[model samples]
Target chain A: MSRIEGRFKQLAMQGRTVLIPYIVAGDPAQDVTVPLMHQLVESGADMIELGVAFSDPMAEGPVIQLAHERALASHTSLSSVLTMVQVFRETDATTPVLLMGYANPVMHMGYAAFADAAGAAGVDGLITVDIPPEEVDGINSELQRVGIDNIFLVAPTTPEERIAQIAARASGFIYYVSLKGVTGAGNLDTKEVASRLKLIRKHSDLPVAVGFGIKDAASAAAVATVADGVVVGSALVDTLAQAFAGGGDQAVALGSAGKLLKQIHQGIANAAS
Target chain B: MTRNTEENIFATVPDEQGRYGVYGGKYVSETLMAALAELESVYRMLSVDPDFQRQLDEDLTHYVGRPSPLYEASRWSDNIGGARIFLKREDLNHTGAHKINNTIGQALLAKHMGKKRVIAETGAGQHGVATATIAARLGLECLVFMGEEDIRRQALNVYRMKLLGAEVIPVTSGSRTLTDAMNEAMRDWVTNVDDTFYCIGTVAGPHPYPLLVRDFQCVIGREARAQSLNQVGRLPDALVACVGGGSNAIGLFHPFLEDSEVAMYGVEAGGHGISTDQHAAPLTAGSPGVLHGNRTYLMQDSDGQIMETHSVSAGLDYPGVGPEHSWLKDLGRVNYVVADDDEALRAFHTLTRVEGIMPALETSHALAYAETLAAQMTPQQMIIVNLSGRGDKDIHTVAEIDGIEF
Candidate 1:
């Protein structure tokens, strides 16, 4: 089984919601990413969604967009991101890692080559924000060949028919955008998220992970009630940004990122118990 | 001119799924797929509905001052000493540019779709002014996203949009240009999809947008063709249009795609030159990639990240082109060329001096190309240039370049 699917299955058996922390690779510095991945795992992150920085991150809010700028400014490229993932695999073999970004950078690397490189780097899945199911066949087939999951996002605005369509093509966990806006956008209505997840469950058996509005412990706990996994991006990235602002303190950034991840982890676990 | 009986494959493009020969698919986030599909279905219904056609036609005729004159630039042609040149006077439209054509059609669509708020993105501000104009007339709320740099440069057009009662939001993100403006606009649409109608100004977005914008602007080609038959007695030997997001070019080229003898040229902005990395001539200098909701020729780095594009005119300073332009360039249906900043400026001045017309710097790229192409042909031949907009908004830039404080 792919690493993502296996991780989800294990978490399901344990009655624990998978906690995924998203960090843009090379955000503050190039050397900080691999260590951050290991740190995240130690702090209770079940999987890592490493963002590949693109020049134009259209779906991102200001927080994540600044993170991308910082990553790009550090001379980060897809190849370097893969190298970081490979290094992370050296110490941790069980934690799943998924690359999340836009399509242009992946297309620049060529689909087959990217799939092979990602698989070799021990990457578990990919979530290209702009590539809908209608346009993902080329990359999807390549990822499938490499045993890497091709995860797709199901938005709150997505209709039932499209949810079924996306679910059919998606492997690993399906990312449900918990709100109607960018990554950092607020106003997450639990009732609305629950209703959407119910419809999504009717269409697919894959684990549903909710992202894009689960900012704090309360929000994560609220989502954990109806979701198999929870993803927190902008809030974590914002923490790292604060560290960078506070005199480029890598230790502080790592500590704060871990602290935030642990709080969300406890939130989910506490709600479950 | 040589003619071939090859069957025209250009008539039916962007098939049911919006694939224009491996380009122009709906490469958006899943949140936007349903909205795009709904728009496609609504446009399909209205495109054929008799009442809707009548309403659009009436708007084009009376409201937008359609059938903009096809004026022959005899003096400019005489100065060039070659092919006769005719200008499709899109500059004479109500909003002083070809942008109003698409805005009017989309505003009408928004009204029909029962959308109360309309949004648009602009680089040079002409499109913003046009959208604001239409939204004001239709009594719909309007918001325009413009890059910070463009808002500073095109202050007059920004003021015009404000005078028309539209809110102009300044985008302060990456590159701070048209591309960023588009990114901001997309975020707004995704957030407010229920009541907001995104009236795209160019032919570069996802499926139905490129298709819809092209259909709305095809009045240029349709009129040019009829005028060619009546005034020139035959299709022109060549057609020329500047391609930014390629709306004006597609509008002027779509109707003549089947005409074997009609040569077409799409002039891209070569800010410095295509050899330098400082130009916006993607079709000439860049490669195919997916960006801004479609796969097209993009100015990008080796890693596929979009590169900052440069041009004298903000309207033409975008990294990506329309997917249809990409397909056409590959099929050898249209000759894609470049005009550098200096050449476009020269042509801008030449047109003003010789033809008593001041072309927008974006449109001057086409005129620059036409000047070169016209000089190579005999006087018996004719070339039609799409005067896509007027240069009134660019007077300050020109004055600054000339070291005059205006």
Candidate 2:
């Protein structure tokens, strides 16, 4: 089993809900990303999903869009993102880090080079939002050769038969989108998401991480009740935006990350109890 | 065997990697990560939904005028060395262009999603006009973003969009053209994510869009298939269309992709020449990069910044093409070549004088190529060209070029 899968299994046995914190890599500045990632883990994050920036992100919400713009303005390439992952690995090697982004950067770099670089950078897995099962073969073989998990998504709209296909290929975990539309645009229908999760569980033995529109502690708590983990992105990016807009000193940003992580943890813990 | 031939071409596409060839892939912002995922799911569901297909078919037949005809241009054919040429008359659609085929399909999708507003970006104003027409018909508030330069050049189209009750927003950003207008439209979609739908003009953008738009525009090919077979007693020797964002080209070529006996050509704009930076031939000079919503072939500078493109025909002035076309070219299924401004202008006048048809400057590129190809072939050879739009909008521009007071 992969490190992320093992961690999830351990957490499951301990009756603990996994908290996955997501942040846009190279946002604000490339130099500060590793520190912020460390801060996230130190606060309470069990796994880290680092978003690689792209120029035209059609499916993004405003919060993440601004973050991408900031990264692109700094000219953050996929190479730089992997370099950051390598830097993070220098200090903390065991903490699972997944590169979460679109497929262009991977395609642009060539699949073999990307898989090698990602493996060397200590990236445990990849969750490309746009690489469907039909297109996975282009990069899947390289990823498998490098021992990197090819994570897949199963949405509420995914039929049962399709879910089985996705689950068969999916490693690491299945990212279950909790709602329709872009992230940060809609409210989560907990009952609907939970029922969908139940259906996914029947077909796939993989851990399910629910994301999209998991804004506050309450939403996180609601998701934790049914999902193996809760992936929070826009809200965290929103917090970073507010902190930076309000004079982002290092102390202020770290403090913001700590406070948000603690609240989300409390919510998940409360829901589990 | 009949059904198998039809299925073979489409099966080659959306390959094991969801790519049409090497052309289609997700090249997007990290912010939209989850949203793209959700869209993929919804698209997969809707693609096979009987209700969705029925609704789209109904709109295409009753609303957009299904099965636009294949007119055998006998006069033009006789003038061009007696080589027979037929025109798929998408220009006769309700909006005077083929762009409505896609806008109407996307508008219905927006309605199904409960979106109250629709936003679009335009270059030659055909897409903007199509979007505005659909938005008005669907009873949704519409906004169209166009480059300030395009707004000035295509003034009548801008007026038409306004008359259709769409708010035309002038974009004064980089190059002040289609690419910049698309950027502005994306910004609008990002801000108004709650109840807005972004109606992309062509078979471009993220994953599902390339697939979705192609499916909608396939009616052009499907209709032409029956018409051509009935009229010519067999399939044409060649399929030709001009590629801007590649909607019309795909519309015509898609149904014939698997016909090994038939050849396909997509003419790109070689503004000054292919060697110069002034051309809009992405397949000829561009590298694979992410622009708009998906990763496709794009004309970009060394720094990976998209370059400004130029074409005498505003519709053919884009720096990138639909992802599927990129893939198609890579797979060698279609030959993508360029026709310079001089050649296009020559054909534009030739069509007007010989055939009494004032072809759109965009379609003139294909005609120019056809003229050249016709000279090299015998009279027995046949070519079917997609006459995508009328030249009415270009009269002012053409007249000005001729030093005539319009």
Q: What TM-score would each prediction reach against the true structure? A: 0.99, 0.74
Interface root-mean-square deviation (Å) of every model: 0.7, 5.7
lDDT of 1 by residue, A69-182 (tens): 999999999999999999988988999999999999999899999999999999999999999988888999999898999999999889888898998999998999988888
**Alpha-carbon runs more than 4 Å astray in model 2:** A9-16, A242-259, A262-273, B1-89, B100-123, B131-162, B165-239, B253-264, B271-279, B287-333, B340-361, B367-385, B391-406
- In TM-score terms, candidate 2 sits at 0.74
True contacts kept of 2: 0.08
How do the residues A1-273 of candidate 2 rate in per-residue lDDT, one tens digit apiece? 888998899899988788999899988788878999999998889999998886545456668878887887777878899999999999997789998887666776789989999998899989877676756787999999999999887765567877888888899998987765566768989999989999999988899999988998999998899999999999998898789889989779878977898899999999988
Instruction: Go through the candidates in order and give each one's DockQ.
Output: 0.88, 0.10
Candidate 1 structure quality by residue, lDDT tens digits, B218-273: 99999999999999888899999999999999999999998878999999999999
Candidate 1 docks with a DockQ of 0.88
